[model samples]
Target: MAESKFEQSLENGAHQKIKSLVGKWKGTSKTWFEKDILADDSSSEADISSILDGRFISYDYTSSLNGKPLSGKMIIGFDIPYQKFTFSWIDSFHMGTQIMQATGNATEKGFSILGSWGNPEYGDQLFGWRTELEIISENEIIFSAYNIMPGEEETKAIETIYKRI
Candidate 1:
């Protein structure tokens, strides 16, 4: 029997690349609340691991915002049928009580995903969030996110550079 595409990926494709990220990482997180304005910069740590026999990758991280403790988890997978990447994220400081789900395609060095969030009480106003992960080298990676508002351009919200530890 021929190997399924996903199975092939697990052996030597995108899944293999994703699995390479499994490890301990230490880095610094920089956040911006307004365009061109730095809000906070702090140390951050993360653990990346493969789950479900390498079908998915989980990123669990801890940091701080405005001197308050913050933590987040993100699960990422490749959808073979859709030919896209799947991502779901939640965090203590940003998500509040909501989970952000996103889908995107692969980039040259990584992937970029877009998601949105809003409150019904706001009456149909939703904000966009874009996350990007770039693997620079065996020991380095860069993670970034942008915030998009209605009728406005996307602004860099957060960026973290990690080194494998």
Candidate 2:
């Protein structure tokens, strides 16, 4: 597909935004959903405390799901000019990548990224989603995840509150 001039501008801005996310952030999160019963049970903690390195533009996220270990490395990058920010991840369970674009700049508090990813385990189905990051400070932030699937009732997948530790 042909690239639009506006897209180029956004891409450039997104790169800088991604750069901002390159730092140590710590927080906690909660999962709330209607159909996704397993995630909403709240039996275990969904807290996150991560350290992001700018040199590699990568992050080490540590958390737990149902009381099991959850950790991954997402190397953040952009395509060009800043149209979108790609999050390439690899961890104990999945070895895949997801990209989220700049929906807009930080609002009252932080920023939001809107994008979708494919879940091969879920029959390679495309899952539309968004992640909101609220910067509490230079060392702490909050991450919230939501599902924005069209035609389907909106659902909350997971929310991770992060802090720099």
Candidate 3:
């Protein structure tokens, strides 16, 4: 007998224990656009909230890089037919809107979210954009962004380490 895809995903999501990620966090982070150190910043905060019983989660992020404000939100579905997450960000300073899909699971260190997405505003400035989120704790996380130009190599757009307040 073989387990169904839904069954497998359910087991995976259950074993992942993503509920440990619910909380509020504060930390400093830096933003690099196209591997060119755009700014080194730390005035940022992140809030993560979730309802395990409801199978819903949300992330609210607010930050400033070089005096410009950046904000984004992510909504996730857990223990469902398909375990996945969705993200959307509107960056006022960079003038970009980013949307991404993610798959997550519990790990020894924390929850790991592997995702990929693109930014329309930076399409010309930077190509083939994607991001990764590593939840270090209930209040700590690391976010890294990547971009690959048509002819040039892939670059890390941003890497930020966050901590709980």
Task: For residue 114, give model 3's deviation from the true position in Å.
Answer: 7.2
Write model 2 residue lDDT over 1-165, tens digit each, in one string.
986654443355544444555555555546665556645322222222222332225656766656666676655455444534455446553333443333434444555666666666666566677666676665666666677665585576776665554
lDDT by residue for model 3 (12-100), tens: 65423444556777777777763676756656777778655535557677887777677777665544545444344445544345555
lDDT for residue 103 in candidate 1, whole number 0-100: 93
- lDDT, model 3, position 26: 72
Clashes of each: 0, 17, 2
Worst 10 residues of 2 by lDDT: 41-50
Please state the error at residue 155 of candidate 2 in Å: 2.4
- Which residues of candidate 1, in runs, are more than 4 Å off? none
lDDT of 1: 0.94
What TM-score fits each model? 0.97, 0.57, 0.64
Candidate 2 residues lying further than 4 Å off, grouped into runs, are: 1-25, 35-56, 78-80, 90-110, 119-125
Query: How far does residue 15 in candidate 3 sit from its true spot (Å)?
Result: 8.1
Superior candidate under TM-score, 1 versus 3: 1
The CA root-mean-square deviation of candidate 2, after full C-alpha superposition on the true structure, stands at 7.3
Error of 2 at 129 (Å): 1.9
lDDT of each: 0.94, 0.53, 0.60
* Whole-model lDDT, model 3: 0.60
